[model samples]
Target chain A: MKTLTVDLGDRSYPIHIGSGLLGQSALWTPHIRGRQVMIVTNETVAPLYLAKVREALTAYQVDEVILPDGEQYKNLDTLNLIFDALLSRTHNRTTTLVALGGGVVGDMCGFAAACYQRGVDFIQVPTTLLSQVDSSVGGKTGVNHALGKNMIGAFYQPNVVLIDTDTLQTLPDRELSAGMAEVIKYGLIADAGFYQWVSDNISGLMRGEADLLATAIERSCACKADVVGQDETETGIRAILNFGHTFGHAIEAHQGYGVWLHGEAVGTGMLMAADYGYRTGKITRAELNGLRVMLEQAGLPIVAPADMGCEDFLSRMRIDKKVMDGRIRLVLLEKIGEAFVTTDIDTNALNQTLCAGAQLGY
Target chain B: MKTLTVDLGDRSYPIHIGSGLLGQSALWTPHIRGRQVMIVTNETVAPLYLAKVREALTAYQVDEVILPDGEQYKNLDTLNLIFDALLSRTHNRTTTLVALGGGVVGDMCGFAAACYQRGVDFIQVPTTLLSQVDSSVGGKTGVNHALGKNMIGAFYQPNVVLIDTDTLQTLPDRELSAGMAEVIKYGLIADAGFYQWVSDNISGLMRGEADLLATAIERSCACKADVVGQDETETGIRAILNFGHTFGHAIEAHQGYGVWLHGEAVGTGMLMAADYGYRTGKITRAELNGLRVMLEQAGLPIVAPADMGCEDFLSRMRIDKKVMDGRIRLVLLEKIGEAFVTTDIDTNALNQTLCAGAQLGY
Candidate 1:
């Protein structure tokens, strides 16, 4: 197992990347503070991993709350179930919640800990590639609102993130591509060399080469942890982390959450942002082409839905977290691996990008 | 207006105590950071104070979410209404929410501010004496859950607490007595001098004498703010501020919230706690009589509800925020104006106090 720490003083925690962490008692026991343990998982993941996790928590008084699976179920209504189970069982402030699934489970459970009794300790045992590389590393936990994605939430960090790469063996191919989009986002916003490494080894990641996937997950989390450490709350530089998310969240909202996986929308959103940056003359067409090739190389979407237009996109994007002072701020690429947030953009250029692949009726 | 600061370093804010603060835009404008304003109030307070608050924010774009009045409405469902309004209006992170009512409105709105897009700035425009003296002074904010009162929440502080003492004139007589419960609590737990002052000036306050009421609000807030500054998250010293809350919250929970006003429940809960303190040999019998006489003098209940018993109290108390590691912690009066938290009390003493008012089937 290789360990990487997200350097947040006092709240700092480790991300353990390994082949089989669920069966490892040491990784799970230290973070479990109280005698009572509430394991929050989903229907899709419980049958496969519940017994193993329960076995590991043998000494503690363990309880399980299994939710229906999917991103669409990620909302305030579903978030209530975790609260219900914890309260009905009379879980106190000292109780520690273990999120034992992918991003949705991790996000929902982490948020429940943040709000339950003001805040409680929680462990993120992220099972999928996307969560292992992205959501599991940062303390950004929240549920999606109908008008926008992740609108109601908190930036509550977990005690430790136990990433079991072995769980990736069961992830669907489409989900893998979604997770890759975020993995690629880290490289696109910060690391040029890492971006090149991912581009060169795209095939290995798709084929699920154990060593190659482990390297990618470790590198991605390191990049995220560095950025998050500099800015815990997005008052300034942290806003750049939402490079493709502004457009991505809009796509998720209008397309109806879960209709398109978060990663797919983000991958497509990156393409849209790359095109917008290129049209605005900040990014060269060649750099935009390189991003398109890489996204395509990883089986990611390079186009917005063929039906969405400039107005539809604008209406949804305007409500995203990226918008500030009524101006829609977006993470636009300056070069292949360099990005900047700018609200001052030419409307015609934005329209041109919006009308590129979709029917805009201009 | 007499101003006192909560002194929480960078998160520190001032509490403005005076008559007719609602019409004072100068008090309202400095804390409001953004152009977008959301006023979260209730139906009862809407006709009374909403228009006055909106008038004060006329320069900025304002929106409102008026909930049904009462404690029964302080839950996740009502919290959703605030989110719906904010989302529907596309209120950004820069949006400032103004909680323009009593403790219910302030608590719900403050929790809303804490959760809305991770968080946003909010001001507490407390319209009730209970809110001005107790809930509004501290940064504790949350909505109620079915299993427990304030079972789900965040310890997010408001940017400012705007206390308009003039609004107390419109408050009903019962509500005024309910507010006194907490006023009496301040004396019983931490301020002997203040307790005697209230005892001597009880009629003036009951009659809503402007000077007497103002003095009581400021002193109560000062006591609360001092404790909160030392322990913001209720780790140790802050728990003492909960004096009668272990039993108070249980009474509130079992009485079907909104039935017995929070202060009334606390008043009765304080009585039960006083008896327990006496039985445990922590306080003199004379001290216990002083508390009983003062509560009766304030028109507050000196006993628990006739329907509850040791078992009923135990079951509900187990789910309170004070419960840790399955042990129920209670705040006992070491002396008038002083209290401490302990979980090592004898069960018979607790039962004796609980069975005093309620006819238990023993």
Candidate 2:
């Protein structure tokens, strides 16, 4: 396993990336301090990996809550299911919750851990590329609202994040490509060398190349850990991590959550941000085209929805968490490996981008 | 006016106890960060102090969410009302939430603020003596599940705790007596002098003597602050703060919530703990009798519910957050003005207390 630590003083923990981690009970045991373990997964993940985790935690009192899979299910109503399961079973504060699925499960379970008896111990076993690269490492846990994505969440860290690359074998081609969007986001927002490497090995990643996948997961987590370590709650530098998220979350919310996968929206949002950057002279036309081509080649939508207009985008973005003191601050790219947050965005400029079909709720 | 600070570094905030604080906008103004503010209260509180708070926050864009009154309303479903209000109005991250009511309002609003967009700025305008002396000072915020009281919550501090003792002038006699339970608890667990003072002046407090009330509030807050400063998340010393809570929460939960006021339940729970202490030779029978007399004189219950059996108490108490490693750890009184936590409790002693119609969730 490749270990990367998110340095958060006393709250810090290791992010382990490797194959067959679910089968490795040793990696999952020590972190669970309490004997009562609640494994929160999803309908899709339960049949595949739930038993593996259950088997690994044989000696402990294990309780399982399998929620409906998908972004649409990521809401307070669904979160109640996890709470109900834990409460009905008389799970105590000392009980350890293990999130055993993708970003949605991890986010919801981590949130349940956060609010369960004011807080409880939770470990993350991320089973998707998006989670392996982004969501699982950061302490950001929440459910979606009708207004915005990730708006109802907390900055609660995990005890450990176990990423088993072997699980990616079951990932559909589209899902794998969707996960690649976040993988691309990591490179776009911070690491130029990784971006170039991704450009060269995109085929290998899509083909589930183990060594390439491990390296990508490692570097992505490292970049994210560094950013999260500096700012856990997105006060300043951490906002850069939401480079494409503002647009992405809006796209998801407006399109009815599950319509567009999180990575799909983020992938398209990144392209739109690049376009806006180009229009505002923050990036060269060639840079914008390069990002557009890379995203399209990765099988992501780069245009606005046929139905949504500037007003729709504006309303959706207005309800976002990034709207600070009424101004919709956005993460705009200056170059492929660089992004910055700015509130000086002109509506006229934004209208043009929104009219062009896309640049970014709960 | 008097102020006490809960020194928790960055999370540290002030607790202001005085008359006319609510009328003075300046006291409530500084803590509100953004121009937008949401006041979360109950139907009962809205009729009483909502307009007063509205007058104070006239300079800002304000919204209000009035929930049904009582402890039964302090649940996730009711909490959704706050989220709905925030989302419907498009309240952003910078928006501030003002909790205006008693402990239930403060708790639900504080929790809503804690989870809304993963947390927003919140100010506590506690109207009850119970809240002002206890809940308002601590940053612990959350709602309850059917399985337990305060089962779903967070350890989120408020920007400022506004305790307008003037509001207590309109408080009913029963509510006043209920509030006294917590005031007496502060003295029982840590400050023997405060305990003696309460013993000496119970009638004055019941009579609503402003000076006496202020002193009780100040002293209770001081003892609570001293303990909470040492342990914010109940890892150690803070558990002592829950001396009566284990039994109290079970009483609240088993009774279908709102049947027994939180302080009332704690009052009975404290007597139960004292009885258990006496049974185990941890405290003198004389000490137990003394605390019981004080609670009884303060107009609080000193025994368990008549309808509840030993099994019910056992089951409900088993669901408590303090149950670590499968052993139900309890906060026990070693003697008057002193307390400690122990999992070494005997079930026979516990059952005997429960059968005795006294002694110590969803």
Candidate 2: true interface contacts recovered: 0.91
Off by more than 4 A, model 1: A358-362, B358-362
**What lDDT does candidate 1 reach at residue B57?**
82
Q: What share of the true interface contacts does each candidate keep?
A: 0.80, 0.91
Which lDDT tens digits does candidate 1 get at residues A259-327?
898898889888888788777677777777777888887888777887777788899988888788889
Please report the candidate that would top lDDT against the real structure.
1
For model 1, how does the per-residue alpha-carbon lDDT over B320-347 read when each residue is reduced to its tens digit? 9888898989998888789988988789
Q: Give me the iRMSD of candidate 2, please.
A: 1.2
lDDT of 2 by residue, B1-362 (tens): 99999989998888888889987988877788789999988888899888888888899999999999998888878988889899898898889999999999999998989999888999998888899888987788888877777889999999988788889899987788789999988888998888999999998888899999999999999898888889998889899989888888888888888889888988888888888888888778777778888887888987778898878888888878888766889998877789999998788988788788633300
> Candidate 1: which docking quality band?
high
**Candidate 1 DockQ, CA atoms:** 0.85
lDDT of candidate 1 at residue B260, scale 0 to 100: 88
The TM-score between candidate 2 and the true structure equals: 0.96
